[model samples]
Target chain A: SQQGEEDPQALSIQEGENATMNCSYKTSINNLQWYRQNSGRGLVHLILIRSNEREKHSGRLRVTLDTSKKSSSLLITASRAADTASYFCATGINFNKFYFGSGTKLNVKP
Target chain B: EPEVTQTPSHQVTQMGQEVILRCVPISNHLYFYWYRQILGQKVEFLVSFYNNEISEKSEIFDDQFSVERPDGSNFTLKIRSTKLEDSAMYFCASSSDLEPQHFGDGTRLSIL
Candidate 1:
């Protein structure tokens, strides 16, 4: 019954700026994952941070987790037009299934 | 470079009709899953399949729902009688070696 809720339901910024999105969950999790969806398309996995990992980096994407707060944050630096999409955070429990948040719609205007 | 593949990228079915969504997970993956996302809503897990059986399923996966991996390479989600509320994007995903999932493009089901 645990659900993840993302902060900033919508974000609009000029290209080249940094976009930050935060997610908070209701219960403990084995890992948290970030995904991006372009309009009505399927989700594309962006990054995953385990409970024990405080932070992770992949290219221009950075994810940090605070299990104590049951929260996670995703930072995308040097954003581009292609990066415009909805970002969702998913909490993974023991079942290997995940619960997703409402998501943050990021629009990077060129 | 293998990925989950879902067929009939889009489908429109009448309400109360049966619809089966098909997905072919990664060739070597053992775990499979089905998820649905309504327009402008969060993704909801429908079920997870492992070892030819359902490992877990969400409440939304009620009596009308069933999953099968009848063949070695295909996994399916069947809705006995789809409702108008069933309109959503159904995604299939697979994980190998217990790693993160790789998702398919998804099948958009629009119940009329």
Candidate 2:
């Protein structure tokens, strides 16, 4: 299906802790992106990792891609209560169309 | 930063009625797309438009669904006779040449 599937459908953690989420896909992709959606809000793009790039970082967010395994992971360091949201990974094969995952609902307790 | 904008945040319509969702993509973007997310489900791609024509579409974008760039800045998605199952959050996105897509806030469609 080329859709990315996120592991650990739900995760609960305390503030100031690090939270990690994983995504796996079935086919080759050109890029993978991560997005966060707050309750009843629009999706906010977090990061993007190309197939050739192994890792990328943006402030508190770290993303890694492994083409051999067709998997990717996102790590949020020092998470705050505001970080609580649904995280989704989308795989783009043609740079135009993307297939999204079911998402991992994250709950960061204060 | 430029952002995609959508109008009519929420719409309520009767089953079998027609609905049109409007979006103003980033001015410089060359690609526009439509997506929908059913309550508690993953986001699904509906169609992609470039050069005033559909570049690609998913199985969900049947004959009843259509897209048009009626003007230079406006992109619209029209659903003819929306079914109850068509209720969902419709999102509009735009991007420029391989860049990350910028998404609008989305329109919530309710078919009763």
Candidate 3:
């Protein structure tokens, strides 16, 4: 079963704009991770936020997790054309298991 | 920056036939997993393997599906009697401890 469900199935933005994607999940999780996939390719790990932590940042990416609300969000600041891709959120239930959501496709126009 | 590698980028097979998808995970990674995505669908987890045994599997992984490490460097997923619905892009992933999983480019399997 899918754990996370991302909102705003698709988003279009211009370069230098900020893009935010939200994900909601149903069960308790040890961690939530975000991933990026270019067209027809494999996934690339973006960021991860643990249940004990509310937020985390890496480069231009910011991730927030709200255990109480059972939701998480990813924000990309100063988006570039290269940032155009499909983004996904996955909830880790155990060390070896992760359940992923249908992704959000983001298009950053140059 | 080691990455997982999968072979036979695309495969076309007949229904009811058997097919094997192969992957070689990062050498030092301890966990391996298999996932699949039907066109325009979410990536779905099929199975996870550790210590040369299956640690977890989703409902989609039925009796027709099997996994094997086979050798030190090879991980494989085999489907016996493939169905047309099995057509999908299958991905292999590996991770070390709590690190995020690294995914392979994936094999596009088409069952005719």
Candidate 4:
């Protein structure tokens, strides 16, 4: 499947610490995007790293893409209690369709 | 910021019934898509529509499933005959060109 696999299905950290999640996919992609879903809510786009781009950042979120390895990582710096949510990595391929990973459930304790 | 919107936050229907989930995508966005998450499972793509036609669809979007852009701003997904397995959270999304898709909170469909 084109769906990616995210390591450490769940992560717990303190509010001031940094949290990192990794994702690996099996095929080439046009772009890799990170999204956060607050329980029972829709996905909120975080950042997108193109196949040719190695890294990208938006606010407190930093994303890195290693197309040669078909892997990506998302780092949330100085996490806050409100940052608790499930984060997913989606690989955008042909026809603009996206295949999503199972996601990492993040918990930030205040 | 513009956003995608879906109607009937939650719907309850019997098996073998037809269900139509409606969505109003972000205005001026040229691409529309439908996706579903079966409880704890990963989000799965259903179909993508552009230029008033289906650009691509997954295996799950079979003959029993159909999509339409009946009007300028509305995009809809119709299931001919719903099944228990059809119970899920269906999401609508829209994007312009190669931009990231903006998603709606989603419609929770329950098939009894």
Model 1 Cα lDDT, one tens digit per residue, B1-112: 8879999899999999999999999999999999998887889999998998888999999999999998999999999888999999999999975478889999999999
lDDT of 2 at A91: 97
TM-score of each: 0.97, 0.98, 0.98, 0.99
Tens-place lDDT per residue, model 3, A61-95, is 99999999999999999999999999999998777
**What is the lDDT for A57 in model 3?**
95
Off by over 4 Å in 2: none
- What's the C-alpha lDDT at position B76 in model 3? 99
Output the TM-score of candidate 4: 0.99
Q: Which candidate wins on DockQ?
A: 3
Where does candidate 2 chain A have its weakest 10-residue lDDT segment?
A39-48
The list of candidate 3 runs beyond 4 A from truth reads none
**Scored by CA lDDT, what does every candidate get?**
0.92, 0.95, 0.95, 0.93
Instruction: For candidate 4, give the lDDT of residue A106.
Output: 98
lDDT of 2 by residue, B1-112 (tens): 8889998899999999999999999999999999999999999999999998999999999999999999999999999999999999999999999888889999999999
Clashing pairs in 1: none
Q: Summing lDDT over every window of 10 consecutive residues in candidate 3 chain A, give the lowest-scoring window.
A: A1-10
Docking class of 3: high
lDDT of 1 by residue, A1-110 (tens): 67889999999999999999999999999989999999978889999888889999999999999999999999999999999999999898764689999999999999
